[model samples]
Target: MFSCSTMMHIPTSQFLKLSKFKPIPDPRCKTKVATLSMGCFWGPDSLFGSIKGIMRTKVGYTGGSEPDLPTYKSIGDYIESIELYYDPSKITYLDLLQVFWNNHDSTDKSSYRQYISAIHFHDKEQEQQARDSMKKMEETKSNSIQTLLMPYKTFYDAENYHQKYILRKYKIFLESLCLNDDEIKNTYAACVLNGYLGGHISETEKVRILDIGLSDEQLRYLEACL
Candidate 1:
């Protein structure tokens, strides 16, 4: 049995073995990117990590001044944001916007810029789709959505601790992958693990990872997650 903390959906164990694991190939062709700021970055990062089309997810600072290397404490005018690389063939940008709006309280009245909600569009098409979605949402509801539709800007990655907040809790699981901090950021395996931590891993996704050359032990661990 997993501990109370890790019993969210998967069993947990401290045992780790470094076996020969195949690198998850990046199968995306002409991927599109999306950026969003909806309260804390951790949840959004994990949330998107679970989606089918997501190739990579990163939490960072954006939409503010003082781009001089933002630390959590020194994030001058920046708000928390998530940068996502996704395949449009598998999931549409509009599909992501739906998930974004559903995950956040767009009507949030918080005065803190860090907690404010916004979507950074990569191009006019995304901007238009966002606006259309916002309008459609308002058509049936009374509360005004406060999510800002802004143009794309710079994204400064947050500290390592904040990158995969949920999955990082299981140090052994990460150690099994033998990935350095930088490697985890770019790895699709990390993305899948992060998503699994967030209860967003689908059965199809689970099966895919099982074939990624994980050891029997690691495969069992992931199986328990499913």
Candidate 2:
């Protein structure tokens, strides 16, 4: 049965055929990591990439016992989560939490745990802040907060098809990055482009894109895709 929240509606045969490209390295890796589960991972994955200070984002599975079996069809026991790498100096964990609550139905409970809203905190500060944010959110709404706030244990990267889904729709934009399938799934530049292609990009984000080492022709192609 297809869950209303799942985005795996396309037949396997109809999936986009993407080409393999060479790797273009991103030097920046000093950033804080935050993970969240807010229904479908694809939506949140695209959403956070748009925000300033968010360096990179990846869709994965967590909050389950059997981490090995987290395929879309078998992820019933796991929560679909987006792991974010962000610069705390630019964007705080609380700020991301604010976006989390705003972007999805935090008060609504999912029939399956996989799509449930959650904040997978990584540290004591994050834990305290996440709980505080939940309380603050609860005070603002009539409905009870149903989001799961817990310490992050393990995160299993989702399948390749699940990575940069929105950006993948614009195959040309992806090819511009010059990344192979494996590298594309984890590239910081890809994350920014994913958000832009997903419709959450800002002017500042566009400038950032221009500065990320893409050639003039590639930039034109990416702009066209947008």
Candidate 3:
């Protein structure tokens, strides 16, 4: 004969699992900031905005002398540009360093779309940390490390309308509130190519240039599939 024991059920807050996403003091989030330049600011802004503990995110030009200027045309674009704010408590600045590696193609051009990776940190330790991570990424990742580590310049907050672009453009975020994390990441990956951008990608292939970048490979793959 087996005896059954009563198990006490503890009411746990959903916050336990998503603890990394806990709301931090963004207003006083004095963590050192960093800037990046990948491509059209809309996608980068949208992707990073969803990340928790990001005090703020801004889009603009960098790696040039005109810190006060706003230049969008890639025709003669000289500045590599983007801006991001993070809370060090939840995510370290180094975590962002790795993020920069995965998100863009550094082989395009020095100042071209997702060509160079640059880090703008405030102090010696932070710079060292970013530099170390950059080196490590170079050794580990298939692509060349084009991320330039430098002092941060002025940050030009994108136009007021551009803020929260994913929320504004996709018309899905409002309802995403009803979903969970895995659901949300999947939704994003699925809906990423919706409409014109959809139906292009073929099945995964064995021949992918891990070093170059995904967008170009993606376009080629889709074309072959079609």
Top TM-score: which candidate number?
Answer: 1
Per-prediction TM-score, please?
0.88, 0.85, 0.55
In model 1, which runs have C-alpha deviations exceeding 4 angstroms?
A: 1-12, 16-20
Q: Which runs in model 2 stand beyond 4 Å of their true positions? A: 1-29
**Which one wins on lDDT?**
1
lDDT of 3 at 180: 46
Give the alpha carbon lDDT tens digit for every residue of 9-68 in model 3.
Answer: 212222211211121122554655777766555556555544544555655665565434
Candidate 2 structure lDDT:
0.76
Rank candidates, lDDT, best first. 1, 2, 3
RMSD of each: 4.2, 4.3, 17.8
Please list the C-alpha lDDT of all candidates, in the order they appear.
0.78, 0.76, 0.47
Error of 2 at 188 (Å): 1.3
Model 1: how far residue 116 lies from native, Å: 1.1
lDDT of 1 by residue, 1-226 (tens): 0111333433455565545456656564778899988887777778888888888888889988773877888888888888999998899999998998787778776577776788898889999999999998877667887778888888899899888777787667777778789867877778877888777877666775664557887777765644
**What is the lDDT, from 0 to 100, of the residue 132 in candidate 3?**
84
lDDT of 2 by residue, 40-118 (tens): 7787777888888888889889988873677888875788888998887788888998898888888888788888888
Winner on TM-score (1 vs 2): 1
